[model samples]
Target chain A: MPDRVLRLQRIARATAVRAPARRPVMIAIAGDSAAGKTTLSGGLATLLGPGRVTTICVDDYHRYDREERRKLPFTALHPDCNYIGIMEQHLQLLATGEPILKPVYDHRTGQLARPELVCPGDFVIAEGLLPLHTKLARACFDIAVYLDPPEEIRRRWKIDRGVGKRGYDKHQVEAELQRREQESADFIRPQREYADVVVRFAPISEREDPPGTPLSAKLLLRPTIRHPDLSKVLAGDRRWTIHLKLDREENGRPVDALHIHGYAPREDSQEVEKAIWAQLGLEPGDPIHTLGHLANGERSEPLAITQLILLYHMLDESR
Target chain B: MPDRVLRLQRIARATAVRAPARRPVMIAIAGDSAAGKTTLSGGLATLLGPGRVTTICVDDYHRYDREERRKLPFTALHPDCNYIGIMEQHLQLLATGEPILKPVYDHRTGQLARPELVCPGDFVIAEGLLPLHTKLARACFDIAVYLDPPEEIRRRWKIDRGVGKRGYDKHQVEAELQRREQESADFIRPQREYADVVVRFAPISEREDPPGTPLSAKLLLRPTIRHPDLSKVLAGDRRWTIHLKLDREENGRPVDALHIHGYAPREDSQEVEKAIWAQLGLEPGDPIHTLGHLANGERSEPLAITQLILLYHMLDESR
Candidate 1:
């Protein structure tokens, strides 16, 4: 045999032998930029304990920093500029209980910061620009989530966040949103179709207490290879029931607000979210935020339950 | 005009105006695996002086570490597997005199170690895998270099180097090389075509006891850009010439082996190197073992002069 062939076989064998035995699980949380993705991820990480969970920002994959993105042909939303394949490959390696060198994009300086070596543990949460856009990266994740708050809600969230640090006033923030909307409109919205769960945090209705919904979080769970079943949570038993109302405003008309009930959410489904509210230690009378609308001080019992219940199912699935 | 559009235009103007006014010259050094590219870049950096010259390793863009690459479909050499576009964009930004947050790759742990903030300097030398591959990155550089040592020499060097840390003996090293060659054959070899200058180091042939080429070097200068004219260096009238036969191997092969002469290395480059060498100036000809490379050995005329001459050109062009 040629010496080279012999060497190849040996390296393959050595690599195989050295490879870690435990497989890492990948979880992707897709949301609009600054749509509480980090905050939510951080909360979950803290709850799960840092050692069991690893968090990765796809934002780190930005080709250029904030300042340079303006000069590029496409916005940061474009998949061509970020190393999507590399991110996918790294996720796979991490899922397999191996370590990877991750490229970091520094938000402060808006440059490729440095390579960060990430070792996967129990869960690898990959969040960033278009994690689900690429087929390979999407394949690596065991569970996927897309946060889909209403446009107004998301706009307010962005404005509030940007106003303090990004040096944008209310008007400037509003303008920046319009500018970014076109670039991300096609790309960001479509990811919802691929999400295992689409989370929307909005208000209950225009007529709720204080004449505005505080915070109602809604989720559209889609079945994927990793998560084939959602019946556990979708099965509407009071155990999983979130009491909330959803209203759609179209053509200057306020449509009827549908109230969600707690009994057997759907037939022929598993009770996945039993005791979810209790897990969050919430009660029927407890005041909480609604989803899809961001009116101030709107209170809803079911929407809050829905938010916590979905989270319950997700955490359980990942575990 | 829409209020948002107006604001975006204003932000764009402010950013464009705020961006660095005097962009620095970027130099890219490309080479095959273990082809002494790092050594050449380091030598130049040392000669140019650190404050004025910054060296960056694009190896940080690797999606996975050595171990993780085992399971990856494409190795780090593959464009898809690396964040090449991001790397290119960062290079472009640096060339424009902007500071970037670059990912850090740790060789010892084989992971993404950290994020480093790199500010552009007068001479930025970027070296690593596929430095010259992409057009965007290529367009950003003022100079490009490809190190083309004979494959046989590169293989030998890889073997010698891998044996110590990788726990590979001669046989294992040979096997690893064979395995790597297959993957690298497709991705690495072709990049050489893009180089503006091709450099190779070997012993002068048929010179019995002709000043032993000590750490000898030779460069084939092909100017790709209009700015840096090397007519002065090629003429070799006023520039320094090195006459070391260090390239001769044990079996009568040419492998640059000695350190000889340096004619009029730039004033700053000389001062920086002198400062570094002063610490190692235990004795005139004492060998300094650093990261497995030998330095400050027997004086050879040609090798030193060649390295210095290249440094002079690089520094002069940088200014």
Candidate 2:
């Protein structure tokens, strides 16, 4: 080959090598209109610390607010309607531990809210529609989760929350729910298959118990990509103790259910919570139970434990 | 219902709902594995006619093919793994009568191959992993689709296609499955959210075991707000005709389906036996099937028709 051709080949090779470094991870969170994924992710950020967590709401990427999804071709589920590729590309950047300026969509007013600067923290928690739903977004997360609430509970939550906070009446909330259902069917619900955990807040047994004070939480963990057995966690190591609880119980009356996780089967549970102790840097006799009293009667032990577990997972993933 | 808030809202609304002048319709086909989305879309496009058909593959948006996906976090299923948002923006421009330089990915090489300038044809079809996935993308299509092929068939199709075209043996294909499954579960399959149609190609009855063809294509048509009723196309409007057929039959069943549009489905299908006829303004007898026949015997009919539907939907939405 001519010298010029050789030079061009070298340049081409260099360019090819450089391209991968330039790309980053783009995580997206796609879910039903009011799935409360944000609430869960919020706790994650708190645990990881804001500096270590970069949160991107896929809703912000919406060209139109919740109102506009109704008139679109495929609802928000279709890639054509959303800047999916851009989000994907951004995610690639994040996965590579790079910084990005992500577009923000304001939920309060359905519009491009702001452009937030996102630097790769120890952990990047992207919560929105389709975050874990795409191949690109999935690659970025060390762990992925889905929040699936009972429809009735979700609706009731939406109604109460809407009236209380979002400034919408029951009728208006219902209308919004109908509109959102179209998009949810087309774009949100399918993301469940991609989650490592499917989290449901409603109580089991389908009882119509008035929404429990605080919230009752249930998480079905489907751990993928397991590494060499960390018997330490199963053995209840102190460090692992913060995030996990190990125990054996009767599951379906006959089957034995064993856990190496933070929550427990008993309502009384353990008086000493590892996750809480780990975060607060407290020992068994820490005086911070005063903070516990701050909870008044609004929170349940499971809820508190669940929060601690979420926090531990976030910090652990970051580390 | 505060009068001031209501009055402000009315004032903020656009004065006229202009029915946005009817433009070409654009349809996006998005799905996972062997979802029969492409096949169903082909039939619709064939009925529509070539003068209004244009096909653009969102698969082309992949930054890397199967091989390169291994080194990446999310593979093509991740939003960051694609140039999706840009693609959506381009589609939007095309729907409004513009052109774009689209990036191409070489499946055989597993690399970014080239970029080609694509003009907006009469009708546009954009299909791929994340098409109709994001808000920006969803805006570009008037119709959106998701193909949900059964896992067994999807795996088989992926295996055969990988072995046949992409140069992967069975073992390597299995390994690829292990690698790609994470991203696929996380991102690629979740795109079902944004689809107007969740299409599956398989037998509904396991016991009957239809001998003719195990794969009976099924589509869950989740029509958009303005999704056109196919009843219009069923009526004999010969202005444009799209043709769809079983392109490849396996075990007495159609393994591959094809679509030709903008003429008589029967006549047009015959004319383009080798090429997938897309783009606009074709003579009645033009060979539209060449696009599909260029590579393997694999019919590009599904791809072509998807483009046509997308084109129609895009134009229609633009109006």
For lDDT, the strongest prediction is 1
For candidate 1, the C-alpha RMSD (Å) to the true structure equals: 16.1
Query: Whole-model Cα lDDT per candidate?
Result: 0.58, 0.53
Q: For candidate 1, give the docking quality class from DockQ.
A: incorrect
Top model by DockQ, which number? 1
Q: Give the runs in model 2 whose Cα sits over 4 Å from its true position.
A: A1-30, A65-79, A206-212, A227-272, A275-300, A315-319, B1-319
lDDT of 1 at A133: 76
Per-candidate Cα RMSD to the true structure, in Å, reads 16.1, 23.7
Docking class of 2: incorrect
lDDT of 1 by residue, B136-249 (tens): 666666678777777887887777677765666889778767776765777677676676656666543434334433433555444343322323332333324322223543
Per-residue lDDT for A57-150 in model 2, tens only? 7655554555676666555555566666456556655665555545566666655433444666666667877776555456555556677888
Q: Native-contact recovery for every candidate?
A: 0.16, 0.00
Candidate whose TM-score is highest? 1
What DockQ results do all the predictions give, each relative to the true complex?
Answer: 0.09, 0.01
